[model samples]
Target chain A: MSNTATDSSETTARHNEKMKRIKAARDKMMAGKTEEKGLIIVHTGTGKGKSSSGFGMIMRCIAWGMPCAVVQFIKGTWETGEKRLLQAHFAGECRFFVSGEGFTWETQDRDRDVAAARNGWEIAKQQILDPRIRFVLLDEINIALRYDYLDIDEVVDFLLTQKPPMTHVCLTGRNARPELIEAADLVTEMSLLKHPFRDGVKAQKGVEF
Target chain B: MSNTATDSSETTARHNEKMKRIKAARDKMMAGKTEEKGLIIVHTGTGKGKSSSGFGMIMRCIAWGMPCAVVQFIKGTWETGEKRLLQAHFAGECRFFVSGEGFTWETQDRDRDVAAARNGWEIAKQQILDPRIRFVLLDEINIALRYDYLDIDEVVDFLLTQKPPMTHVCLTGRNARPELIEAADLVTEMSLLKHPFRDGVKAQKGVEF
Candidate 1:
């Protein structure tokens, strides 16, 4: 017991010393990184939480009292829990636009889907240009691009020409275009390891939404 | 102009019909999935949003008036934005435990880290058994496991034996063990394609934190 106690104290001392060293190193590293700019964030791949993560950023923006807009491309009709919560809590500061009629598989008509996507893009372009909107979430815009509904070059050019220098934009969906990925400041690909849907478990409220 | 207007209206009608069919199909799929059970969710990979996504779920739980607990294993010292927000807003319904001393690279002492991890596990095990807590987030527990501070078998065994059958649990971190993956009900790996940190951008308030 006595040996154990002594060893524990020694361990604490060592841990403290180690932490001090790390803090010093981290502080030094951080000191060199002072540039701050609005990020073009992309969330893509075949996993859960791509759009959910985008909403998380919206939560952060809300906490900071920043004006934000969300234009959901392919997930409009469902009464999502997030839509209800955000609409109720942050009506004035946030604008939620559901542009897509439904999933492409459901729509099936390429022309109709393209028209809907173009409509959403027009709204998204307006949001991106609005200086009042600090964060613009082009939710599932990548899907529209993936399906060739929206011109990738045009979207990229529009993003590059935003008026406000500090307006952050987040695009969430699977199969982000190579051009978008190249232009993005931060990109997170949510890879799927396992999904409940594969096991016949349907989407759950307050979890999937 | 007349042709364009006519085409637009026709597209809208088609989109509406498509959405109606989707809603019906979705309703039928949802109706068949009536069973509700506790989910073992794993959020792992080298991306940025694993913990952020977990916290988003916490927000959902809060909206539903569910009691939740967070046991942060490897991210204790940082004054994360999520921690501040959750603590302030969901004070009574949530319990936030910062159990780890710091990151492994910072601490550097294996024995000390092990002891700290063990201590956190004790708290987590208690939270898991607590009947009142509906959601328990073991934030960065995988990091502790990666460093061999905690036994994967023991952790998995404990999770499998939770008292309350309805308590959902989320484990977040990179390098999740294969055993844990096999046992998880749902798993998402946040794959990193690009990060501002790689470009020497410092972690920003209300964004990275």
Candidate 2:
């Protein structure tokens, strides 16, 4: 037999042994996990896909024929492609509440921003309590919390106490509070590696919006 | 006048002034960016939403009536919720090529894995060059690259040289190569903050799969 063939066979055998060990470990690890409940998922940090991932979850929910609600806290200035598409496809099934005036810098007045956040939170809270809404997306609620427009304590308290047991809530934005993170069942922090905006590229119509 | 009324008026005036300044800055910034081209986006890291975010981009492309393709490289062990959902909605518009045998540990054969990766890459390259495919997702391709099942140099070269100018390509997985990162237009690392698996929660039906 050739030396190359012998070496290849040896490697294959070793790899097979390693895989056996891995499968055993993974099976043991997975066997311990049997619980299922509604998740408080937070997508935060300085990355591009916080809102995008939240929308993906909504799509998954929609595919399962679950009624979903989206409460936009700081993205009401311009119309989004998602809003237009979801409205066209899921008119009665999906309820969208765009309560924010605009971004904080765009709005300029902290008072108005506060009022908008409060209004958005009211809708979000109502959605959370509604058993009909299987998933509630508090879109960009982290920004409102970061700016202190909405009280973190109250938000955390509601998440802990008032939400229906079967409704999943997703909060998306940068700089998610530690308190919210503590309360979340799953938290993903999107780390910015490279962005096209830094390279003088404008956001395209369907890509960004 | 009452204190509340005076404060409200001052706040509105200040907000309007701030919005004007913001519009000027944003307009000026946007004016400088006039170039448009296809983007090579990478979603990597140890988080859970890497593939979910790529699917979000696919959703965006679908909204624009663009034809898209999904070539899953390492997630073919079981039926995924996304595959079922997207296939049902996008019927003839989207093409899904699930070329993976399974995870490495499950397959336990290096030679088979390499062959699967090669087959998947051929389809990926062909789809990437197709004008009809506006968006192509190489889902979990990074895992194939990391394991050396697929040649990173060949993948990087194809991405750099052969991609259609207006066709966006999204690569999703953990541990994306530095070369791929350098070639990508946008790269976002999904940082793992907290996962339900660690808290004795198995992957749920509609949420994880």
Candidate 3:
């Protein structure tokens, strides 16, 4: 990188003037954004970081001293570093609920999978209703809804209407239902531009988990 | 959710058979994935979760007992919940470094911005070479590169060639340069389908932070 670019006072003055205009516009825009409410955030797409972002949000909630819960829906028994870390570091501050035997194709038992999703939702509902709970991460619940293991309408109704107005909620998974997306306040699609797995590289332990 | 769909023996058999085929194909694909190497992961786009994903990766590293460092480039001195949480829970395991006055348009001083980016890069280089450090998050460095505060080619060469082969790295920001994207192993673009800010909703405290 260039350490210095011949500090020209004349050019600096012009740039400063341009910045002044930008700052004024930005201040005006921000001044209008006065409403602050808990968001129904959806992280869904054919890429990584759906669950990772949820974990990060949980981290933020824990840092700010908010009671949070994570319900890993349609998950496996495999131990994830994120789960271990949250349990170890923020134990009481955050709670974890893991259900299901893995992905749908892997399990191949629709009854068992449906039972698991219902069990997870039971836990999620309790957390969502608890006035003490400030955040809930419905991790991979979209996959359950995709498989018709859970009713999207029922889930959306409880989240958008029954839950406390200030309780933040995040749902993450690939192929999120349209109703859920329509109900979400913020929807971020993590588009997969490139993945190392395509190059015959297995998932790395800490990074992938 | 349907409690049960009348356990049909023939339907169950068909599902089981189809799943077996999928498992076999999945196993064959996984058998070829033997390579294990550090990844240059990039998270960029005009959406949320770029930094959240990076924070989650850092959490993963910490959980797995890997020493990590985070360098917030071109950032203002706003206190983030992620930074505070990392410092409070895993101080010795992870380090935090923040540089720059803020955004390029806001700072309006090219020389000072360049100096700050360079300073952050120097710290990043040290962290990358440190054998003890397993992960480093170059948070918002893309913005610094976008403003020409740091040379993208120089940064890419250092990260791709000089850094330890086993160490993982992540770059987070919107509008990442094409050169950096070319060198990265995994790239996820967080596309903003909907944002609350556009509807006059300010960022939430714990959730957005």
Q: Number of clashes in every candidate structure?
A: 0, 0, 0
- In terms of lDDT, the poorest run of 10 residues in model 1 chain B is B1-10
Model 3, position A7: C-alpha lDDT score:
49
Please estimate how well model 3 matches the true structure, expressed as its whole-model Cα lDDT. 0.88
Each prediction's DockQ against the real complex: 0.37, 0.57, 0.72
**B22-140 in candidate 3: lDDT tens per residue?**
88899899899999988899999998999999999899888888899999996656678998998888989899888767777787776687889999999999998999988999999
**Model 2 over residues A1-209: C-alpha lDDT tens digits?**
13498897897788778988998899899999998778899999898888888877777777777889999999997677677768777777689899897787776777788899999999998889988888899999999998777989999999999888777899999999999999999999998899888778888754676
Give RMSD to native, each candidate. Answer: 4.4, 2.9, 2.2
Interface RMSD, per-candidate values to 1 decimal: 3.7, 2.3, 1.5
TM-score of each: 0.84, 0.92, 0.95
Question: What residue runs in model 2 are displaced by over 4 Å at the alpha carbon?
Answer: A1-3, B1-24
Across A116-144, the per-residue lDDT of candidate 1 in tens digits comes to 99999999989988888888889999999
DockQ ranking, best first: 3, 2, 1
Candidate 1 local lDDT, residue A37: 73
Computed on alpha carbons, the lDDT of every model, listed in order, comes to 0.83, 0.86, 0.88
Per candidate, native contacts kept equal 0.44, 0.62, 0.73
Using lDDT as the measure, which candidate wins?
3
Residue B171 shift from truth in candidate 2, angstroms: 0.4
For TM-score, the strongest prediction is: 3
